[model samples]
Target: MAASVQRLQKCAVSPTGKHTASVIFLHGSGDTGQGLRAWVRDVITPELAFSHIRVIYPTAPARPYTPMRGALSTVWFDRLKISQDCPEHLESLDSMCSTLGAVIEEELKAGVPKHRMIIGGFSMGGAMALHLACRYHPDVAGVYALSSFLNKDSIAFQAVEQRVAAGQSVPELFQCHGTKDDLVLHQWGEETWSVLRKAGMAATFHSIPGLYHQLSRPEMELLRSWILAKLPPDGP
Candidate 1:
């Protein structure tokens, strides 16, 4: 048997024929962007039917996972062991942030306003989404993190404090996690929310009972509503 090859790709959906707001979907570790397309199209679009928006899903580069049986798959960063936080992880964080920033810039040039852009992802991608939204100085509309862990708590806290000192208003955040999620756990989400709240950031945290590491249909519905709420109406 031959090793499977992976590739990075992008998909866009614009139902009203023109783009008004946009949502960038980042997939979880070991998964391709294509995995989340049907979910978004089938679940999110109908809920926000009135708004004409574009959804972008981008795949990450494939790499070897040393922590998981030397598995070759796509990940925003190399895997970290359970309950261990490493400062060295910041390097991968910076790389993903840079890539995501470039994608946002491209969308802006194509006509999406900074205030109408929503950055979101699942698992590792979710962590990257939240990290970038907090550090990136653009007028990001919102951020959604699903079943993800925050990397480098000290650095993230410091960044929040610095932003507050500099008189910057943090973007709104929606964080959801399964109470039974062993991979990241609910406590991680609570801690992240605590830090955000202490810094006066607009944040909402939800714990889905009995859910695991995956998203549920109702959760997707909630996300759709949350995204639309952040976007302005089609007309003034």
Candidate 2:
């Protein structure tokens, strides 16, 4: 684990000065924020073209992951023990959500409106992003979760339901998962999409045939197009 970053304490700003929108992509466990930031360079092309879109890659807090037998890594939470359901560590979940909320608030205070901010991530990161978007932050542009699962019984569900009942437009979503993903089964993502849709969320799930616990180029292409549609460069 790297001792340099404790969390997404810093925002990775785009060189394009006149930014209109912002995105924060969380990396999977074991990956560093700096590494993911560099990797995203190819995904976000034409720097000048995307000048108005600021993208951030946040570093998760370093911690001992349960599944990894206490091995320390940059993780969103500590999975105490697993069963037929999602990770069950309410305290950890709450703390991680607070950390994520702080990041979102920072962006909001920095002049990025809630509607122009998009959040998503991969694996554990994806799970946290989905958790935040669906339960806590509902004013974002859209959520793009990849290879992740959601904790259905979270207390946040009530808030999400209330938001819908109030007729407020919540963040739209595009969830991507690999059919062959063994770590976080594709079914988990599907179930999450189903629950959100049943709750009246504008969300969709895409299942890539042969992808596993990793990202695929095709998946990125889909995400890119979806993002472009959500926040067009010409849009104000």
lDDT over C-alpha atoms for residue 113 of model 2: 85
Candidate lDDT (C-alpha), each: 0.74, 0.75
lDDT of 2 at 11: 44
Best lDDT among the predictions, by candidate number: 2
Clashes of each: 0, 0
TM-score of each: 0.86, 0.85
- lDDT tens digits by residue: candidate 1, 1-236: 11222334776665465667778889888777777776555655453343467777888887666578668878877646544365536766676677777778777898888888889898878877877787874368888898876744546567777887899866788889988888456787778777877877788988888888887877887887798789755622
Model 1 clashes, total count: 0
lDDT of 1 at 205: 87
For model 2, residues 1-236, the per-residue Cα lDDT tens digits are 23332346544757365777888888887887776666555554532135677778888877888888999888887776543265457677777777777777777898888888889998778877877887778888988888877765655455567788998777887999988887446776788778777777888889998998777778887887887788776665
